[model samples]
Target: MLYHTSPNYLSSQITDNDQLLFQKKKTNDLKEKKDAAKQKLAKVTFACREEMLKLREQKAQVQLEKLTKRKDKIERLIKLEHEIRELNAKTFMRIKPMHNPTTTTLYQNIVNIFYYMMVAIVILGFTYGMTKIAISTFDSLQNNQLTIIAAETNLFKLKEGVSDIFETKKVTTSYSFES
Candidate 1:
């Protein structure tokens, strides 16, 4: 009875050991699957980070190109403004007068000479006309005075003839009485 019982106890112990070994193998398989998943997640995160950096670099390049174009445009506008100012200055110079002082003075002198000559001629003509008028007036006054004297002498002679006629009439009458 003791020997038989010992064999039974040994068989039970071996079965229990086999069950523990199978459980340990299952746990190891689960742990390996979890580690593989973690590795895959890390690789994906690294790829995403690299893509974001590339996008940022492209944006910076585009901004630099825009700024360069704006600078070029401003420089062109400044050049154009400078050219316009120069043209305006040249035009103003051309528009200004270019008079010759000598020629202008000569023309003025000629005009003054003509004006003086005209004034002298007018004064001479006025003087000559006044002299002629004075001479004609003097001759007319002398003729009037001579005509008045001749008329007075004729009146005196008529008065004397009348007086002699009256005296003769009176003497004839007295002689008639004496006779």
Candidate 2:
């Protein structure tokens, strides 16, 4: 199995082997460059997509805040409108104030009548109190007059008795017992 080849055959075999190795090395280098380009493009695409998503999220947040404020404002306006309607309904519910003729005159007449009635009652009460006081004063004066007349009659009787005793020649006798 140790058969020797000729020199020509050996040189041809070496040249063919070197050509194949060179071709293989070229293909490997091309494949490595293509892989590097693909990796770089993938990284760039990923970064772009991430930035787009972040911007979209920020825009959505701003829109949500605007929507929330708008909703609150609408609710507040509706509440104010409801309160205004209730106030108007409550204040204007009465029909008499809206259709009465000379309402001012009627109101004033009523107030005046009440005022006069109260005045008359107060005057009557004062007159009654004054009449009671006058009657009591007259009774006290009559009682004083009667007392004065009785005292005068008593004094006259005492004077008469003294005159009678004087006319009878009354003498005073005195006796003393000494111990």
Candidate 3:
């Protein structure tokens, strides 16, 4: 190939070199801007991750504190319930001893009085029955003795009358069969 060297072509070749140098400078500026943007994004991502970790730790701490408070409250409630039960037991003990004896004695005295009254009534009934039996027996014995006397008198009169009718002169004495 035969080379043709022209002055205009040589000037155009210098201008093309200058344009290439400008394009290269523009490319370097764009690359620096891209690198700076990437660095800013990396910093922002790291800060966000750190803040998220801090939030998680704070939430865990809050939950732990809540659990501890709940446990303390439960313990206090249990202690209060136990104290109440103990107080109730003591009160019952004191009241039981204080009240039981008087009522028991009262009931026992009433029962004793009733028993004595029943015994007296039974004794009186027995005495009355015995008196009635004695009175009836004495009355029957008196009536029988009177009837025997009457029968003896009748027998003596009849014997005298028969003796007179037969005109008997036998020697007779009073018959004595009494022992």
Number of colliding residue pairs in each model: 0, 0, 0
Ranked candidates (TM-score, high to low): 2, 3, 1
If scored against the real structure, what TM-score would every candidate get? 0.40, 0.45, 0.43
Q: Write the per-residue lDDT of candidate 3 for residues 52-118, one digit (tens) a residue.
A: 9999999999999999999999999999999998896565433323324532343555565677799
Give Cα-based local distance difference scores for all models: 0.73, 0.80, 0.79
User: 1-179 in candidate 2: lDDT tens per residue?
Assistant: 22338777778778888888988998898899999889989999999999999999999999999999999999999999999988855644421332344334545555656777898999999999999999999998899889889988998898899888776655553557899
- Ordered from best to worst lDDT, the candidate numbers read 2, 3, 1
Query: What are the root-mean-square deviations of the candidates from the true structure over C-alphas?
Result: 20.1, 13.2, 17.5
Question: Worst ten-residue run, lDDT, model 1?
Answer: 94-103
**How close to the true structure is residue 145 of candidate 3, measured as C-alpha lDDT?**
76
Between candidates 1 and 2, the one scoring higher on lDDT is: 2
lDDT for 135 (candidate 2): 96
* CA lDDT for candidate 1: 0.73
Give one digit per residue, the lDDT tens place, for model 1 in 1-179: 67657966778767767777777777777777777777777788888888889888889889888988998999999999999988965654333223323323434555655777898899999998999888888888777777767777777776777777778887776654453
